[model samples]
Target: MLDYALLAALAAVLRTGSFDRAAQQLHVTPSAVSQRVKLLEERLGTVLVVRGQPCTATPAGLRLCQHVEQVSLLESELRDSLPALAPAAAPATLRIAVNADSLATWFVGAMAAAPGCLFDLVIDDQDHSAEWLRKGEVLAAVTASAAPVGGCSSHALGSLRYIATASPDYLRRHFPGGVTAQALAAAPCLTFNRKDRLQANWLQAVLGTVPSPPTHWMPSTHAFVDAALAGLGWGMNPEHLVAGHLRAGRLVELMPGRPFDVPLHWQQSRIASATLAALTRAVLQAGRAALRPAAAA
Candidate 1:
């Protein structure tokens, strides 16, 4: 039989990333938290946490943490059904991975619609967010792939449209004649990070080949548009984010009428819990309102 108290201690330590923080959150002494973690590790005969400034969980520990979180969600559901059960001391935290672009654009609306749970968001590239789910690190993800991760259900969230934009001055200076392949090779572009492929993908789609352009690695989604407006570099900016700039001539499309639409999906574990179902409904509704139809994309 599992001692839920020991498991809770381990979960709290991992979630807070420190024994001291865990102790504060659990309303226990730091020494007690440390003792609980050590006892649980001894029982499991494995090193669950690697002690450091900010402790990290081992693979086995990660699995246990995930289990604890899922159990919490199940218990929360049960409490709702059984009024006799005492309410939890704190709201459950649901960890999810989402692309920065979606977070800057429409994901918050989905999050806001789902109440009664705190959220721990992991921002990653849309193309890679699903990896968090596959690793059991996140309960749900906003991903570019339509294929469902194993044990998870996928929902079509529609496409987020991107426009390849730059300041008018930068375009004139970089592509004097037009947006030609040769000129693109000489242009400087904005990349979100090493994992970012939006600019490259846009290049390939419009030019039929990718260019090794000089890059300015700006990681923020909003900063990408700011950099473009300042002529730091041309980049793929979200349509909704840059629509006003485009209309005001503060930004111009590199290729007029050629918008890049990246289709996004919401994937979550197929647990028969009301919490997940409620979140999924809110996500679908928000996606419908904010994104272009999946079929249209």
Candidate 2:
């Protein structure tokens, strides 16, 4: 029989990424947690974790942690429903991984709508955030990849439209034909970082050449938007984030009707917890309302 304390320790170790941090969180000594995990691994006859600077879970460890999380959530729900339990501390928190563009645009609203739940958000590029889910760092993620990670399920959230945008003054000075490859290559460009290839990808798709402009890397999504609004250079702007600016003429959509669509997906561990279920429903509801309609036949 598996001990709940050991299971809790396993979950904590995975969550904190280190034995020392898990010990601090659990108010127990690291040695004690280590013993508990060793005992648990012996009983299960499987290697549960990879111990290093930042601890990682083995496949078995991932499964065990997911089970522990589901059990913890269920217990919390039961305690919350009881008369004297003081609401059970919000189901031990729901950790999420999301792309920066979504975080800058619609994700904050979805999070705001989640009452009585605590969230730990890990933000990364849409294409890469699902890696966190695979590593068992987050319970769910908003990702660009349609393929689910191991032991996870996924749903399409709809496409996010991005327009190549610039301030009108920047357009007048640099982009005469709105943004041909030749113009983009010569103009200064703004990007989130070196990893941000949205501009390069768009240019290649439209004009069969990559833009090798003088680049500015503003890593923060909000700051990137602000820099473009300040006419720093042309950047790919999510339609939702720039809608008001475009309408108010603070920013101009250089490509006008031409837009690129990146498909978004919601990926989550296949665990049955009311908290996760509720969060999934809320995110899907918001996605339906906020995202563009699916591609037509």
Candidate 3:
């Protein structure tokens, strides 16, 4: 028999990233949270959480959290089916991680359509959002990873195409000659953040060895494109975002025919529940309509 209180403590510490915050959430003292975690570690004979400013869970800890989440989901299902056991609290909020570009483009549309349920949206880079799911920070995620999380299922949403683009004036000033590896080394570029490698990846695909150009970080998806249109820097813009500009000859493609592809997937915990199912269905339907079926032009 596992001690659920201790398990809850472990989950809270991992989720909140601090014992103090976990204690606040659990309506207990920080000392109580610490003691429960310590006792749980002793009982299991394995350390679950590594103490730090923002704590992280070990593999064993993650497994335990997953189990707790599963049990909670099952209980929710049972409660929903049996109205007599209904809780006084509001509906459980479903937390999910999503990348910025998707949110800026097609993801919000899906979310907008998914009404009547509470959502806690976690924004992160597409490549790394899976780590949130792995750590049990989110119940679901839209990630570039094809490999599913431990207890989650994955469904392909399709490829998000990116085009290496620059405003015509910026290109003329930076590369009087055609886009070449030498010219690329000198031009400033726009990036979402330090974690964003879309620019680097696109440059590498074209230039063999990547260039080290100074970058202006515009973290917002809309701001990132706006910076490019303002001739601040060249960056990999989402194909759809640049389509109108490209057609109007405002932005020129570095590689006219070849576009970078990032295949996205909807990954969620393998629990069957009404809310999760409805959310998944809405996401898949919207994604299929919005994203490119393939990388090609």
Candidate 4:
């Protein structure tokens, strides 16, 4: 039989990132939390958490955490249907992976639409977000993958449009000749991170070849627009973010009339649960409303 109390202790430590914080949440002594975690680890015969300044879960630990969360959500649903079974429990948290661009633009509206639940957001590139679901780390993800991850349902969320944006001054300085592949090679561009392929994808779409451009790694989605406006570097800015600036001539496209659109999808576990269903509904509604239709984009 599983000792849910010990499992709860483990989940609490992983979520709160420390025994003391877990103790506070569970209203138990810190030592009691530690003991429970240790007992659970011994029972499982594997190290679950990597203890550090802020604790992190191992792969096995992450799967367990996901299980705990799913069970909690299921129990919450049960209580909702059977009032007599209801007990006072903290609002269940839904851990999901979403791209930073979506979060800055439209994901929050979906989050707000889903009530009675807390959120633990894992920000990653849309192309890679579905990996979280595959790894059993997240209950749902907003991803660029059209194919569903194993045991997950996939829904189309339309396309997020991106424009290769630069300040007029930067464009004048870097692309005086034109947006040729050779010129693009010498120009400095903003990159979200190593995983970011928006700039490269845009380059390929326009130039038909990827060039080794000098890059400025700016991870924040908003910062990408800010850097483009400040003449720091050109980047593939989300069209929604820089549309006003585009109209005002503060930011200009590397090539006018050519925009890149990434198709996005929502993927979630196939497990039968009302919370997941509610979240999926909100996500589809918000995403469809915010993103451009792929054909139109």
Candidate 5:
């Protein structure tokens, strides 16, 4: 009973997060897309979208959009197999959400392997990137959470090891032996932007008190690593990213024997698109090669 054209338009609007971008992609005026959505909502007797600066789908809208995306993907697969039925162009854009750290490290290789697909990368913390998937902002995500978002599937990528690290000069100038509760309170620490509290959390776990180190806010993951290497302050760095620096003697691991492990997951929508499926498999394969094994039971 639903109009396929209107459903496709709705899916486009939800995917792009704005009327203007969806219209541009669809090669129609923004007004025309808006009219189509309005008509569709009227026919369905539901408020399907929350119109704002960055648009969001209502719960009903999300369900409908998911259905539409699945159908679209299925159709694309069928068309791909039947050359006579194939569309002129394959869907070129794939929207994905990834944490800043993963994006800085192993994710680039997976992306490089995806030669023909255009990517829209949404960067957020691993802990929260799945929310973008739930809202239909992205079709897939690299997240810390194991729980899959609704209508999505998840795979355990592997553990991302974090080492408590600082520059040799910082260690010499501050907590010379090793970091302790009292020493950490007085030291300067580097943080990856405002939302990063891993350093503080580690302090709390070890000492039962949060460190009140004078903080330097370096937002970029790469920059945060660089700042730590430059002896800005003590912080947790992803082991892989800091491996070279540690070997080169540019940085030193503060706690050589103990390391924190953060598990990573790859979450993707349940849509049956061959391209998405292939991409997911490739990422998982790459992750298994790159990451540490699961902790023993």
Candidate 6:
């Protein structure tokens, strides 16, 4: 049998990001929670969690946590097969990582359609969200790369196309003579975060060089669009998100028919569970509907 208590303690610490919070959740003293994790580490003869303001798991810790989560999900499924043993109030929750653009656009429909299962959604850049899969922090992720991580599978979900867009007022003020290299160099640009390269990519494609423009780093996808709309800076807005704005003349495209397409893939643990299968189905359906169709993947 697995060391359930030790594993639970470690998981709680990772989830809550502090031993004290984990203790409260686990209904143990803070010292007790810390001791349990220490004992597990000693027995395993490896460093697990790196203690800090927000506790983070090391690679060894990540593997253990992933194993525990997978086992829990499988066990939940087994319980479901036995109606007498299944707890009605305890539906298994899927922890997933997704890009901010997808979350802001098409992903919510999938969540809404999945009625029974709960979700813990972690938003990361599309390019980096797969790291969460490799680390086992999430059961599934919407990622940019199609290369499957070990112990995981990837499915091409389609592509989210982004257009360089700005408010009409901002465009009038910033680019009076259409998009020029000099105009772009002087214009303030909006970025989702440091990890976001869509803005830079668009700039490079347009100007033949990526200029270091004044940047407003807004991390949220919806907020990034809102910031652009509020005339803060030009940004690459996902087509689905800016469609309404474009139709209403609220936003104008700087580059028409030259959208920057970032193909997306659904990556998930190579585990058999009804919940995961269902989530994959819903996401695939919703993504196909929202984004441009790609070659079968």
Against the reference, the lDDT scores of all candidates come to 0.92, 0.83, 0.85, 0.91, 0.82, 0.87
- Summarize candidate 2's per-residue lDDT along 203-292 as a digit string, tens digits: 877778775889898888777778888889878988888889999999998777879988899998887667787788888888868888
lDDT of each residue in 1-297, candidate 3, tens digit only: 688889888978987899999999989999999999999999889999988878988888867876765566566667778879956233456778999999988988898777756676889999999998888768899999879999899988998999988898998899999788888888899989989999888887877789899889889988878888899999888887889999999888876887898899999977777778888999999998999784543
Compared with the true structure, what per-residue lDDT tens digits does model 5 show for residues 1-297?
679778877877988889999899889999989998999999989989899878888988877886775566566667778878849344556778988888877888897776656677888888788998988867899988889899999999888888888899989999866677777888888888776767876776667888588988877888888888788888888888898999998999886776777888999998767779888988897777788875664
* lDDT digits (tens) for residues 1-297 of candidate 4: 578898899899999999899999999999999999888889889999899979989888888888898888888888888989857468788999999999999999999998988899999999899888899889999999989999998998999998899999999999989888888999999999999999999888888889989999999999899999999999998888999999999999889999999999999999898888999999999999999875643
Please give each candidate's TM-score.
0.96, 0.77, 0.76, 0.97, 0.78, 0.88
Between prediction 4 and prediction 6, the one with superior TM-score is 4
* Candidate 1 ranges with C-alpha deviation above 4 Å: none
Name the candidate, 4 or 6, with the larger lDDT value.
Answer: 4
Alpha-carbon runs more than 4 Å astray in model 6: 18-24, 27-32, 46-56, 84-89, 295-297
Full-model lDDT, candidate 2: 0.83
Candidate 5: list runs displaced more than 4 Å.
Answer: 7-24, 29-31, 37-70, 86-92, 114-116, 134-137, 147-152, 176-178, 193-197, 204-209
What is the overall TM-score of model 4 with all chains considered together? 0.97
Q: Per-residue CA lDDT of candidate 6, range 1-297, in tens? A: 879899989988987889999999878999999899999999999989999999998888978877777777777888778968846434666889999889888999998876677787888999999999887788999999999989888989899989888999999999999888888889999988889999898878767899888899888888878988999999998888898999999999986777888899999887888889888999999998998887553
**Over the stretch 1-297, how does candidate 1's per-residue lDDT look in tens digits?**
588888899999998999999999999999999999999999999999999978999999988888888888888888889979999877777889999999999989999999988888999998999999999989999999989999999999999999999999999999999989999998999999999998898889888999899999999999999999999999999998999999999999999999999999999988787888889899999987999998843
TM-score-sorted candidate list, best first: 4, 1, 6, 5, 2, 3
List all candidate RMSDs to the true structure: 1.4, 4.1, 4.0, 1.4, 3.6, 2.6
Among all windows of 10 consecutive residues in model 2, the one with the lowest summed lDDT is: 85-94
RMSD of 2: 4.1
Predicted candidate 5, C-alpha RMSD: 3.6
